[model samples]
Target: NAGVTQTPKFRILKIGQSMTLQCTQDMNHNYMYWYRQDPGMGLKLIYYSVGAGITDKGEVPNGYNVSRSTTEDFPLRLELAAPSQTSVYFCASGRQGAEAFFGQGTRLTVV
Candidate 1:
């Protein structure tokens, strides 16, 4: 099964543009998270959901939004993109206290 899949591996957006970074997992994990990594920095949580219909904001959720309508999908939306939002975004999932599996990552650039 596809552990975790993220679409649009790369994207370039103009300032103020909007986009959705798609992610899905077939592992049926109960814990899912969205994180972003800036160059030379550690991963910063953007959002997370423990299960469908439940969500919470994370460390840097200022310009992003997320929803979990099903156990398999968690999509991150970026509104009015900015240079500071440019980073490598990752989606991960795993059982509680277990290792999380990550997607290939979506590299986004805002000019």
Candidate 2:
């Protein structure tokens, strides 16, 4: 089974469009995180889920939302797309104190 998976590796959205980036892990991880990396910038945390039915906002959660209905899935939704939100998003899952398994990443461009 795959350790972690993310759909729509690349996408371009309009100024006001919306989309959900899908993430799933087969490792039954209790911690899942979403991060975005802009050009020439470091990764910024967007949202995270500790376990099933428990989710929390990260540093840059303003324009995004996440839901963790199951331990294996944590999807990120982007509302009201904007050019400033263009970046590569990564989904990661791991245990409490171990290394996380990351998805290939979704490249989003808002034009």
Determine which window of 10 residues in candidate 1 has minimal summed lDDT. Answer: 92-101
lDDT tens readout by residue for model 1, 1-111: 779999989999999999999999999998899999999999999999888999999999899999999999999999899999999999999898899999999999999
lDDT (C-alpha) at residue 61 in model 1: 88
Report the Cα lDDT for residue 95, model 1.
Answer: 90
- In model 1, state the lDDT of residue 29: 93
**After aligning candidate 1 to the native by TM-score, how far in Å is the CA of 76 from where it should be?**
0.1
Query: What lDDT does model 1 reach?
Result: 0.95
Clashing pairs in 2: none
In the range 1-111, model 2's lDDT, one tens digit per residue, is 788999999999999999999999999899999999998988899999889999998999998999999898899999899999999999999999999889999999999
Candidate that scores best on lDDT: 1
